[model samples]
Target: MAAKKKVAVAGLASVLLVAMVVAVAVTVTKKNGGADSGAAPVSTASKAVQAICSPTDYKATCEQSLSKANTTDPKELIEVAFNATIDSIVEGIKNSTLLKQAAADDSTKQALAICEEVLGTAVDDLKRSGGKLSEIDVSKVDGYVEDLRTWLSAVITYQETCIDAFENTTGDTGEKMKKLLKNARELSSNGLAMVTDITSIISSLPMGNVGSSRKLLAEDEGRILYHKDPSEYESGTEPKFLGKVSRQLLAHVKPNAVVAQDGSGHFKTINAAIATVPKKNNVPFLIYVKAGLYKEHVEIPKGANKIVLFGDGPFKTRITGNKNFAGGVKTFQSATVAVNADDFFARDIAIENTAGPEGHQAVALRVSGDRAVFFNVNIDGFQDTLYTHTYRQFYRDCTISGTIDFIFGDALSIFQNCRFVVRKPMEHQACMLTAQGRVDPRSTGAIIIQNGDISAEPAFLAARPPIDAYLGRPWKELSRTIIMQSNIGGFINPAGWSPWMGNFALDTLYYGEYQNRGPGSNLAHRVHWKGIRQITPQIAASWAPGRAFAGDYWIRATGIPYVA
Candidate 1:
């Protein structure tokens, strides 16, 4: 009887799969059924697939892998190829376990374990992307194409990171261990090529489809996105209301509750106050914190909706910890503050990881929630400083100082007028400013900096950061970052960006520069990668902070100065 029940469930799943396939087919058919005017002729599905695969180095493999997919849409073709690549990587993961057993030394075995973890994470990331892509509609939301660009770049990175484990494998720092990683690398490369082709197609889409002339996704006024009219937003008439955190908003926007660390206020600790807030509460919940140093890891868990955390001041109100990789903690775990609530807001607070440069991979703040805003906040650390793990985030007038992969994650983020300071690295180690990791093309995350300043302390760097510090490195294979309309000083390297090492070419990373001034803004010396592009003035403005992140829709509510 139990076997029969299991059979029934399997049959139900098969039927559901068929239904989904039919629905997709109908959607595609409807899209193609549109009227087409005479202009020579349009390419067929097979021709479209062939044309799409043309940009890939492994064209035959690309064509073969995408043959079963019926859609002619470039995005669809790329998605299909990515799914195939994911399947291939899963198979590669099985082989990785075998490779681990074959490791020649303890170092190699440890590296293989890391690689195995990366493989597992990569699989999960790829699966998550399928859902993320659906949320992007270029005609409605801005930054869709850019998000795709960054996410795919990250997907490529996951494979490359796994492959990177073999780097410096000596048997102690030689090059012989790479052969074991060839299969996974090849599969990722193919996926990367397909994603790169998708970027090209999107870039060539008359600029309009990518983001131009698009309407806001929703009408969010008076900080109430649901009241009166939760209708789809229209183009040209963007509502002036942005949720700003002013004295007025604070007085009127009463926190459903308030907390303080000094016992002088409502609560003694952050977690205690968070514990008081009911789960899945829909109302705007504000947590007004007092000035004090709270040495604790805090999380405003998921569904703790519309939380607003405002502190006395960035310097006076601080949250600090010293967890690091050297302390047997993962970088993600080292985060002094982990915010997992949606529609979260924070202002005038400092979140820091006290772990010094020697500790390595220490994270000060890890935010994996949607529609988050940080105003006048200080994020300080040495490595892996700020992890915008996932979701849509906006950082305004915040100071983030770190050394290696300082700001890295898989979230769609925009940094407006924020300061990124380079902290000192140990010995001969160099500082890398931003490591924007978006591992799936369909992911809705990309790092955008508008009118910010990149600065460093002379005393902070053991070696002067001038020619050594890079603006960023492709943490993910198709890592996407745009530092435009910002003042870049000499702290950044002439190359602008760095490769991920071990044959990780800059050709796949999509780093862009637009109207950036100062000594480090010299684009003539920037790395000439196949994916990088210097945008026109018209195109550059479209990617400005307010337009790209739709800041006017939500940021004004913070009362923070938003140039967009």
Candidate 2:
């Protein structure tokens, strides 16, 4: 009797699957002006497509991209959208290959080569997003949505990164590449919008998580917290809203490999120690560097997963390099330290680039990993410093110093109890601390600096009068950044945020401040741009680690003291 019941359930599921496939076929036939020969009404799939694409910015692109989907399931439809984006990007890569072969000089050819690489990365990101979407648990839609948003945002940034590589190259190669990618970019943006709209789409459907709603400001703007006195703390003492992991935890960490410049440990160079790390590690592979200065470009390469890199202290143990764009390396390759694997953790170390202000685009640290955490570390450089290159990242109790656009990237990152030290730039060049690259509205990538400090170096503070500084400028069209509950130094410009160009991204970007302190936090003379928002605490909380990056699930596993 029990076996018969199981067979009945299996047969029912098969029948439902056949019905869904027929519904999808009917919708596609109607869309293509073919005669509908199925009993399933076409409106079932057509209405679903309309509802999903309605929330997207490029409605036509979203609808047309999903027109050939083989299933009426919303999840399968999104997979179809991702597959369409991949097809478009593959075509873009082919065009880029042809253009690179016809380049007039080495510079143009190199730029085209960078384009091909980044575009390939973009395709990889979309493929990953599709795979994640396929494994989504309906009960945990919020967490899955955040992960999807981060990956899709990286896809948009990769496309823009390809275009930025052509800044110094000659000819219409850059323009030509842009034209080829126009459709792909639109499709990617539509993919993000569809993901953002997934909650509503699921709620409308008879789903398990229909009762669970995303905690966003639009739904609870009435719950606002009034500001307290910024003077509660002493003038020079920084406010502490979140706690840090104890130094005792560091003493307890046992190392699998040790690196020291004085030959007192397992390996003298950091790379040598990394080479010994076990491949395909399922657990943390601990590596400790004692105390000394090591000068070499270090990369925690892809597939070197779950590496724990610790040092004695930031000043006592340091890694430095001088690779810059002017030094004939690509900006993506100029990092003194690059973490390209997932679940990477670095503690109590310093990574810097000593190329000075003359180096056009030197990077101190470039992190292109998922779930990467940096604690009690110093990342210092002149320009294009700490590149939060991609993925979901967390930085706590870290100090990052740079001159212009020092902290930049498309990562969905949160900086808690961190410090942003603005250094002096070249003659007549103003300092802009952050250059966030969030190109799509639905991309969940944002720079959230809460319970932190933003001040200038002593020399930069006393620079010439015309050498001013601003919080940040938009590096992409839909860039998003928020400076909340932090101390902003008086050296910052009264306008707070700077513009990339004349009115560009001013009306499209998302810039906000909530309950910030210090002279630079004043909003009396702040920019009255459409993109800037006087956000509420509710909105600020929405960007917190627990909600924004789904930190509650993964952060604690790293033994990091996060306030999620």
Candidate 3:
């Protein structure tokens, strides 16, 4: 069965590549004029632009963005596209600033503020995409292309996030913001389309497997689950995957600063300790947060890279707040602990948004940094608990508890040997483990839960309310998530998944499950949506920490052991 599915997918890939190649050829010929035609030959630069942009979704935007590039190189053209996307985002920021200043109501003002912040993020991602494009190694073009697509897809997610923040705002601000960002979003999509084309052609060829060689389209097999006592999993010791280096770093390394609330450390607050760190730090700025209940909000701003934050334990040392949509704080700005820089490492810590279910869209831990790692931590909230905002992240042996859409974001992340706790919610409030927002099909943004545990809290189980809970719903058009080798409790709805809107993204989103255990893992009554399926072991492996995002590129440095 797997072989047949592989053959079908390969055939489809071949047809797609042939179509795209034909399109490029026809476009180049048309632009160069036929051999018999008496037209002047076009410049090599013009031909390059035409060929590269021909198969893109937004050809006009692609050509216009690359029109100024005089080089006859495809890579140069892509770089120009990235630059154009950056320019468009910059312009959008300007417009958002003007709108914010002119906003009358507080809601409009706050939403516009979010737009400004996310637009800056979009610019940063575009710059990173451009840098990656410049550093591509032709011999390993597959990896480079995958990286480019991931970043570009993130660029699109950032723009859409900006626009989505304007929902329910007064006036035509949302519409205006959407219009302003149309070009930027289109350019980003075009860039992703081009990058995907590279891998698509490679996969269609006979060349050895390069970057996700298989495009599995097999149906999921039904499985019977033997019910287990939830108490066993809850009481079991959490599996530790921290390597020797990580253990040493967390246990023996002296912190650069200490944050204590009892006036015993260098600083009394996390933010104060963060202020002492050098800007654009290239080396690790370690901070040991002493055992105390920190009630203040914390933010690790951009440029403060390689910050190592650890604490006594999840219950001993805690950082928490109550910012939420109900309190007029924009969801993007409501995180209790927001990590916005790269190479962020946190261990034995707990972050939470104390906002109850009534306080909707309250984010507990929001991470936007690339290559961020969280181990032995707890992210607790009611509505939106852990927000994997953007970039690449990994969480191990951590407990993330929430009510609705608890684990949500648009990042490429993996949860290995972690515990997903579903807490009791307001009446009739369904529990959603994740709401991944991968809008771009080419984007590598996904949530992969490997060897994890998903169960309800004791209070939730005691209530025994008919509160339906599912694995996830389509948060965006191309939302992608996979649960592999995990234990799902019976509290989860029999369907296994839910829908965001009335069949809005049911056909486009990608949800896969493989080799899962527990009663909830049964596939007999799972949603039969077009995008949901049971994937083969080979397909599941592609989403592993090693294969998904450049093998051990960032994970090894973080000292986190992974299933390679």
Candidate 4:
């Protein structure tokens, strides 16, 4: 009776297998450009054999598809390869008793090591591949689905093989193998389910050209906290709205004002301007600076908010000061324009510290504002062109040029369609784009660059102290940055990512990229660091402040205007 019941269960499993094969065959027939011929039904035994072979053949076909698909889109090919590799690894582990056994025997130990290595590599590959896939168009869904099916079938086969192996084992080895098989099967099944969920989500997404989905993806809910209809400025339309204020209501300098060549504006000197500004208030001081090149150092202390520093234009209005990091001060401390004031806005201005490339950390603009915005501003310096110290800031259509650590900051900021030009210095200096210092895990400490152009000119000499540069270094543990949907020029190092000044940064940074296109997007030989993660869109979206970090507070502050 017991034997009959076991046989009945096995027969039921065979029936399910047959049904799955027929479903796949029907699907393939529908996809092919051929008429389906009604054929006589095969015996159950033949149907079972075909079902067993179908998954294996499907994997081979998937590999071929990836090879061909790579010709048109290497990114898609990479995704297919990654999925296939991971599935194969999970299946292989499931089938091996050595992986399941806890014995110190040579075979078991070797198998265990191999299993660990494969799993680690799979996790890393998945992260990187997932990030790349987020940037692809929805049209790739069919290919992804087909690839997933192949992987799923492989996993199922592996589980069956492992069960059979366990049944044939003996003594302690058999018991250990059985336990291992159970765990392996559970893990593989969970992983397969996760892939299925991801595919389902992709399928449900509205299908259209890339342009149609751009708005849906870019509309970050957290942006609502900082959203505002731009002010109507002389430069056509703005992204945020500006309110009218009395010209006479001077928190520091009067509105529609001018500063002359001798540093004698309404407030006389830079110190005078800083001193006159009232302390600890949300009311902004409107300093309408005229078009002139003023050679002086400036600092806006803490408690100053809503300060509007306006100039004629970046070319016409310049604040030039000379300072270097080697001169006793730290890199972040040496700045020409250091603003600790919250809610700071600067437009149509150029802040440059002409201390030369010799200055290891001469900063142009050091901002530590809660809500800061720079528009049409040109920040010029050799090292640390723009130091976003803390809080949230946005740079819109600005030109930031520097040689080393050009854009180093610890702020949660976004650069929208901005220009990042790498200036080659007389000495060989390794130019790094960012060094994000995110102190707290809860803090939103990520630099997002959306649609930007990077250009560079050759330097005069080679191999200076800081000339051999990396694009960026992680200033602190858990520092994050994303260069999404952008073009990287050849001037960028072939290695792409840079290590910190010392080995300390290696263990703490979380650097990654998504949908970066152009000649420099290749990551075949990127640095192998555990901290650097290639994340998914879902993970990236969670990092958004309004969505995850400071949702309520941000929404209350910005009350962002809804723009169609």
lDDT tens digits, residues 392-412, model 4?
A: 677767898888778866566
Q: Top lDDT: which candidate number?
A: 3
Ranking of all candidate structures by their lDDT, best first: 3, 2, 1, 4
TM-score between candidate 2 and the true structure = 0.83
Clashing residue pair totals per candidate (backbone < 3 A): 23, 0, 1, 18
Each model's Cα RMSD: 10.6, 9.2, 9.8, 19.5
Cα-based RMSD of candidate 3: 9.8
Cα lDDT computed for each candidate against the true fold: 0.68, 0.79, 0.80, 0.56
Worst 10 residues of 1 by lDDT: 233-242
lDDT of 1 by residue, 427-471 (tens): 787778877765544444577888889988776644544337888
The TM-score of predicted model 1 comes to 0.65
User: By TM-score, who's the top model here?
Assistant: 3
* lDDT, model 4, position 45: 39
Per-residue CA lDDT of candidate 2, range 418-437, in tens? Answer: 99999988888989988999
After TM-score superposition, what is the CA distance of residue 397 in candidate 1 from its true location, in Å? 0.5
Screening candidate 2 with a backbone cut-off below 3 angstroms (N, C-alpha, C), the clashing residue pairs are none
Return the lDDT, model 3, position 174.
Answer: 87
Query: Model 3: runs farther than 4 Å from truth?
Result: 1-34, 37-42, 138-146, 198-245, 248-252
Clashing pairs in 3: 220-534
What is candidate 4's local distance difference test score?
0.56
Clash count in backbone of candidate 2: 0
Residue 264 displacement in candidate 4 (angstroms): 10
